[model samples]
Target chain A: MARVELNGVRKTYPNGFQAIHGIDVNIADGEFIVLVGPSGCGKSTLLRMVAGLETVTDGEISIGERVVNQLEPADRDIAMVFQNYALYPHMTVYNNMAYGLRNRGTPKDEIEKRVRKAADILELSEDQLARKPRQLSGGQRQRVAMGRAIVREPEVFLFDEPLSNLDAKLRVQMRLEIKRLQRSLGTTSIYVTHDQVEAMTMADRLVVMNGGRAEQIGTPMEVYERPATVFVAGFIGSPAMNFLEGRAEGGKVVVNGAAGLAAPADIPDGPVLVGLRPEHLAVVDGGAAMLELAAEAVEPLGADTLVHGRLGDGQLVTIRLSGTPTFGEGDRIALAAEAANLHFFDPETGRRI
Target chain B: MVENRPFATFVSHFVLILGVAIVAFPIWITFVAATHDGVRITQVPLPLLPGDQLFANLESAFFTGVGNAREQSVGMMLFNSLVMALMIAGGKIAISLLSAFAIVYFRFPFRMGFFWMIFITLMLPVEVRILPTFAVVANLGMLNSYWGLSIPLIASATATFMFRQVFLTVPDELLEAARIDGAGPLKFFRDILLPLSRTNIAALFVILFIYGWNQYLWPLLVTTDKSMYTVVMGIKQMLEAAEESPEWHLIMLTTLLAMLPPVLVVVVMQKMFVKGLTETEK
Candidate 1:
C-alpha cells in the first residue's frame, strides 16, 4: 500500500562486528524487491531492519511516511513470513491466521471473515483450517504461514526465504503462487533469498548484495545484461561469467602474450579483466576466434552442454552451448563471442570499466 | 531386542519381578499389619494374613488419630498435607515460570548475577537452612499457618532451571512471529510458552508435590500446634506416642493414608510425566 525507503541504514553488533554497511534503497509502491546474496551478505539483516526486527544503527527507514527505526514490528504495519513456517503448533490454522487481528482487538465476526477470506485465497479448505500446523504437509504449512501474513492486511509483506524449507517441486509451485498473489494484492513487498534464480524470476527489481553492501540494484534483465560490477557479472548467471586476466591494448585484449580477441572500444589501454558469460561464448571455426580453450571436462545437461577447461594462460574457463555437444575431455577447441557481449573491468578495482 | 534370546528374556523378567517385590515389601507388610488388632500387631511374629480389623482400623485412624495425637484427626493432617503440597507445587511453577521468562527473553543489568543467585539456592536445601528460615517465618507471623508449611519450600532452583532450559529451546522465530502478531510479552507467555511447557509443568508438579508432602524437618520445626501438623510429621508423632502405648494398626493405617495421594498422583499422570521428562516438543 505504501513505498519503503532506507537511507544509509547500517547494523553493527555490540561486539564491533558490522553486519550491514550503510545501505539506501527506495522501493516504489506495490513493487516486489528481492534482496539476493550469498550467506553472510547481510540480505536477511537488511530485511529485518526494514521490518523493525533489528535496530538500524546509522540511518532512517521509513515505511509509508513514518520513520520506523524506533517502532515495534507490529506498529510498523508490516507482516513477515519466516523461513520456518513458524505457525503456532497448538493453534488451528484458522486461529493462526486470525492471531494478529485478534491481538489487535478486531471484532469476532471480522476476524473470522478475514481469516476465512485469507484461507480461501490460499486455497486452504475448511477441513484443513481446523487442523493444527503439525497435521499439515510442508506446502500446506507454508500456505498457512502466508495466510497468517495476508490476514494482517498490513501495508507491506516481508518474506524471509519462505520457500526454502519446501521441497524443490513445492518451492517452484509456491514461488509462482507467491508471485501471482503479490501481483493480485499489489502489496509493497521485500523478499530476501540466496537463490539468484528466484530473484530473477520474482523480482520487479533485484538487489544483489555482497559483503554487507548493496552491489547492484536493477531489473533482473538489466542487471543480468549489464552488471555494474565484476561481482554482479560473476554472480548473476548460471555457470557464472568467465574472467581472464589480460591487458587492454588499442581496443584489443591481449591474453597470455597473445593479441587476437577484440575488447569493447571504450575500454582504455591498461591492465584489465576480460569478462564473458558462459552462454555468450560460441564454439567456432578458426576464422573468427576469441580464445582457444583446452577442454578438461564436459557436462552434457541435455538442454545445454557446459564445457569447463583451462585457457592457454592456465586460467579456468567455462563455455555453454545449445543442445548436446560432442566435445570430449582434453579436446582443444576455439571459442568466439560477439564484441558487444564482452565486459571489461579494471584489474586494480573490481568496478566495471 | 535384537537377539531375542528366550533365556535372556526370562532372566530379565525374573530380575525385574524380584526388584518389584523388594520395593513393594513394606507396603504389603503395612497392609497386613493394618488388618490386625493392636494386641495381634504387637505379637512376637506379626500376622502375615489379613484380619477383619482393616475397616475398623481405617475408621479409627480417619476419625480419631492414634494414641496421644487423638486430639487432631489424621484426616485433618492429610488435608493439611494436600493443601501444602498443592500450594508448593503451584507456587513454585508460577514463580519459576515468570523468573525464567524474564531471564531468557529480557536483558537487564545483573541478569546473570540474579540467575546465579537463584541457582545457588539449589545447594542450600531446607534442611541446611532450617533454623534461619524458621526465624524468618516466625518474624513474618506465618509460624502456625499453611504459608509456614509451604512458602519456605516453594522458591525452587531446580524448577527454575528446568523451565529456563525449556524456554531456551523454544525457537527464536516463535518470539518474532508473536511480536509481529501484536502479542506483548505477557500474552506471548500465556498463549505460547505456558501451553508449550504444559508437559514439563505437569511433570514437575508430580515431583514437587511428593517433595512438599514428604517434608519432615521444616514442618516439625515450625508447627508446634498439633492442629497444624502435616501427615508426614503426624506419622512421626504417632511413632513417638507408640513408645508409650503401641497402636500399631491405627499407626499403620495412618501411614498408608499419608502415602496414597502422592502415589495416586504419579500413577494417574504417569504418561504425561514420562513424556515431559523425555521430549520437549514435537
Candidate 2:
C-alpha cells in the first residue's frame, strides 16, 4: 500500500548516544526489503524507526509520499510481528487477531468476520482460535502473531526476527511460509534478521548493514555474485567468502608459499587481496597457477562437504565441496577459482578492485 | 507406589490433619465463644458447644447502647463496616490504578523521582500519617461523613507500587504492539494494560479490601458520631454498653460476623494473590 522512504533518518537515545547514523533507504511500493546484519548492527533499530516505534532523532521518514517523522506507530499504517510474538496471554487467538480492528473502531460483526478470515488463512483451528496463546505451541503462537498483523491490512508488514524463536526445521518451514505470504499479499514489508540464510532466501532486495551503515543493497544474487565491498562479501554468505592476503604485482597476485594467479585487471601497484566463494572453488588435480592448500580439516555433510584450510599468510578459508571429501585432515589438495568468480580487493581499504 | 508406601502415606495424612487443625482452631474458638452464655463465658473453662443463650445474646447486641446510631447493635456496626470497606476498597483501587497507569506507561519529567516518592509512602505507615491525614481531611471539611472516613484511609501507596511492579513485568513488546494497533494511552490502558493486569488487580483488590476492612484508628478519629462507628470501633463500644457485666460472648460473635467478608475473599483468592506476586514482569 505504501513505499516507505527513510531519508537521512537517525536515532539517538536520550543520554545522547547515537544508535543509527543517518540512514537513507527508499523501498518501492510492495517491495519486500530484508534488513540483514549481525547483532547490534542497527537493522532492527532502523526497521523500528520506519515503523515509528522509535523516535526519529534527526531526519525525515516518508510513507506513501507523506512525511511521518512525528506520526505514531499505529498511524503509520504498519503492522509489526515482534520477535517474542507478544501475544496477549489472556486473550484467545480470535480476540488477538481482532484487536487492531477493534481498536480502529471496526464493526463488531466485521471484526469477527475479519478475524475468522485471518484465522482461516493462518490455518488456525476453531479450537486453537478459542484457546489462549499460552495453550498454543510456539509455531501456532507465531501464526496467531501473524494473524494479528494480517487482520489489520496495513500498508507495511514489519517483522522483527519473528522466526528466531522457532526450531531449525520450523524456522525453515515458517521462512518459506512467510515468503509465500508476502508474495501473495504484496505488502511493502521490511523484515529484519541476523540470519544470513533468512536474508539471502527471503529478501527481494537485501539491505545488509554494519556499524550503523548500509553495507550493500541489491538483489541477494547480486550481493553474492558482485559484492561492492569486502564486508558485504563476507557477511552475505555462510562460512563467509574466503580472503587470501597477498600483493598484486606484474599482472599477478601472490601469496607467500603458494602459486600466484593472474590478476584480471591491470596490475594494482602493490598490496591487494583475492576473494573467492567456497562453492566456486572446484577441486582439481594439483597443477599450474591455481591456489594449492595444505588442508587443515574437512567437514562432511550428507549433501556436501566443507574444506577448511589456512592460506599461506594464514587467513582461514572454507570451501564447499560436493559429497564427502575422500581427502582427510591435513591432505594436500589443489583448488581452482573460477576466473569470473574471483574478486579482487585493495588490501588497505577493502574496496573491490 | 501406593502399595509400597502405606506407612509413610499414613504419616503424611497425620501431618496434614494436624496442619488442618492448627489452621481451623482460631475459627473454632470464635464459633464456640459466640455460642456460650454470659456466666459460662466468664467461668474458668469456656463453653465448647452451642448454647440456648445464643438468641438472647444476639437480641441484646443488636438493640442496646446509644440510640438509632446503633451503638446498641453489633448488626448496625457490621453494616457500617461493610459500607466503609466497599467504599475504601473501590476508592483506593480507582486512585491507585490511575497513578499506576500514569507512572508505568507514560514517560514524564521526573518520572523516576515521582515513583520513588510514591513508593516512599508505603514505607511510611498510615498509622504514622493518621494524625496529619486526619487533620488534612478535617480541614478540607470532610469530617464525620462517609467521604471523610473513606478518602483518607483509602489512598494507597502500596496498591500503586504493586500495580507498577506488574506493569513493569509486561513485555515492552505488548505495549509496543498496542501502540502500533493505534491505541493512545487511555485506550491502551483500557483495552490492553488493564485487562492484562487481571492478576495484579486481584492481588491489589485483596490487599485494599483487607486494609479498608481492618482499619481501626482512622475511622475512629474521623467519625465522632456513634451511628458511623465501624465494626472495629463497634467491638470496643460493646464493653461500654455492658452496665453490670460485659457480654464477652456476644462481643466475640459480632466480631466473627464482621470479619467474614474479607476472610472469605482472601480464602478464595489467596492463591491468585500469591500467583500475582510471583510474576517476573519480564
Candidate 3:
C-alpha cells in the first residue's frame, strides 16, 4: 500500500473550461478517502487524475515515493472499479479477474491461483466464474468487478461510484461489503460519489467539494458537526442544516425584530447567518422556547418525526424530534437548541464564525 | 396487425406468395434446363420437368468445363472464385477493422480528415476508376493474378463505417478499464475490440463474400489467363459462345455450381449474420 499525495492538482480542458481549479490532498497509507460532491463539482475529475486516467494538467501526484503524474494508469499500480462495472463482456469471470495478470505476463499457475482466491473471497462459485458477465445477475456482476480489482492486488484502489448502478438494497449491501473489504485489505483508496450518505459511511476522511474546489476535508463527523463553510454545513447532513438571517449585537442575536435568541460567544456586532441542524433542535416548553415555528408539514418517520415549518421571521426550517410528534400541519410549536449546537457564519464571506 | 382481419390476412398471404413465385421462377427454369440435353433445352416451349441428363451435365461441367471457357475446367474456375471471394472478404474485414479502430480510439491529427477521405471512396466505385486501376495492376505486373482480382476491390468504406459505428457504441469505460489492466493500444484492440465485433464481422463477411463471388467485370478486365477465370466470368464466357452453338445445359449447370459457395456461406452463418445486423452484444 502507498500513501497518495495531490499537490495543487488542477484540470483545465482545452476549450478554456476549468473543471478542477486546484485541490491538494494528502492521503495516508491505507486510508479510505472519499471525494464527495454534487455533479460538475470536479470530484470525479480529481479521482480520475489520481487514477492516471486523466492528465493532471498541473501539479504533482505521487504514489509511495515516486511522482506518478507521468505514469500510465497500469504503471501507477492502481486498479479501478467503474460505476458501470466495466467488466469485459466477452470473457468469463475467471478471465476477467485474470486479465491484468495475464497482460502483465504473470505465470499461468500464479494467475489461476490469484483469480481463484479472489473469486473465493468474493463468494463466487466455480461455475459462476466460468460464466460470462451477461449471464450473471447485477449483484453477481458487481462482485466479479470487485474480484477483477482484488486479483490485481494493486497498491491503491479507485472506485468511481461503483455501487450506483445497483438497486437500493444492493447498493447498501455493496457499500458495507466494500467498506469491510477495504478495511481488511488496508489499501489506500480514493472513492468518488455524489451521494453524501455513501461518503459519510464509507470514508475514513471526507473531502467535500464545491464548484471545483475542496470546500472542506475532514472526518465525517468533524465535517458534519463543525462545517468550515456555509456550503459544507448545507451539503453534509441529511434534511440539511437550516439557515436564518439575523443580527448579532451585545451578546445575543435578534430575529424577526425579537432580541432573545442565544448566539455563539465569538460574534461581532454585525449581521450573521444562523445555522441550526434539524436533529439538534427539540420541542421545548412554551415559556422556554427560543424560536417559535408554524408547522407547515410533518413527516412521521418511525424513530423520528421531521417538522418542516416557517419560523416567526418567515425563514423556512426543519426540526427533527425523537419519537412521534404531537404537532401536525398548521400547529405552532416552540423549538430550542443548546448554544453549542448552533452554527454561525459570516453573511458576507460564507465562512464559518 | 393485432386485429387479425381475415381479408387483410388473405391479401397479405397472396401478395407474399406472388413475390416468392416471381423470385423463384427463374431459378426453377435454370434447374430444369440443367436437367436436359442442349437439343432438348433449345426446343420451343421448353420442358419445365426434369430430364435424365442431370448427371451427364454435372460430369461434363465439372470435368470438361463450359464451351467458350472450356480451356480451364469448371471445377478449377470454382476454386479460383472461392479463393478470390475468401481473400477479398478477409482482406476487407482486416483493413476496415483496423481503420475503424484507429478512427474511433486514437486522437491523432487529421483523424476525421482521414475517415472522410476513406468514406469519400464509396462514391468512386471500381467501374468509375477501372482504367486507372487496370493501369496500376498492369504496371505492378499483378495482371492474371488473384491479387489483381481481389486487391482493387478490398478497400471497403461501408464496412469501415459499419465497424466504426460498432466501435463507437462500446462504452469508454471499457477502454479505461483495459488501460488500467495493463493493456497497450494494440493489445486492447486484439483482446477487447476484435472479440466484441465478432458478430458484426460475420455479417459483413457474408455480404462481402457474395459481392466478391458475383464480381464479373473486374476479373474479366484483369485476368487474360484461363486458369485465373472466376466462375461468374466463366458463365459470361459461355453466354458469349451462345452466338454460335449455345451450350444451354452446360451453361445452366455452370450457373448452378457458381451459386453454391455463396449460398453455403449464407446458410452456415445465417444466425450470426442476423444477430450482427440486429443486435449489439456488449
lDDT of 2 by residue, B1-282 (tens): 537788889998999999999988878777788777778889987666777776776777777643233444677677778788888888988888899889987889999898889888876776888778878998998987888878876767888887888788888998899888887888878877787787778877777778788888888788888778888877766667535566678777777777788889898888876776565233
Q: Write the residue-wise lDDT of candidate 1 on B132-189 in tens digits.
A: 9988999999988999998999999999999999999899999999999999999999
Q: List the residue pairs that clash in candidate 1.
A: none
Best by lDDT, which number?
A: 3
- Candidate 1's C-alpha runs over 4 A off are B2-10, B242-244, B274-282
What is the TM-score of each predicted model, taking all chains together? 0.97, 0.93, 0.97
Q: Is candidate 2 or candidate 3 better by TM-score?
A: 3
Identify the superior model by lDDT, candidate 2 or candidate 3. Answer: 3
Better-scoring candidate (TM-score), 1 or 2 = 1
- Compared with the true structure, what per-residue lDDT tens digits does model 3 show for residues A1-353? 99999899999999988999888899999999999999999999988998888998999999997999999999999999999999998898999999999999999999999988888888999999999898999999999999999999998999999988899999999999999999999999999999999999999999999999999999999999899999999998999999989899986887767645777676899998989999999998998787889999999999988899998768999989889988789999988888889899999999998
Instruction: Show where candidate 2 strays beyond 4 Å.
Output: A257-259, B1-29, B43-45, B64-71, B271-282
Tens-place lDDT per residue, model 1, A1-353, is 99999999999999999999899999999999999999999999999998878888999999998899999999999999999988888788998898899999999999999988998899999999999898899999999999999999999999999999998999999999999999999999999999988999999999999999999999999999889899999889998999889988888888767645676778788888988999999999977777889999999898889999998879999999999776789989988888889888887888888
**B1-282, model 3: which lDDT tens digit per residue?**
588799999999999999999999899899999999999999999898989999999988888877788777899999999999999999999999999999999999999999999999999999999999999999999999999999999999999999999999999999999999999999999999998999988989999999999999999999999999999998988777644787999999888888889999999999776766564557
Task: Write the residue-wise lDDT of candidate 2 on A112-153 in tens digits.
Answer: 888888888889999998898888899999999999999999
Provide DockQ values for all models, in the order shown.
Answer: 0.74, 0.63, 0.85
Which pairs in model 2 have colliding backbones? B64-B72, B169-B281
Q: Fraction of native contacts in model 3?
A: 0.77
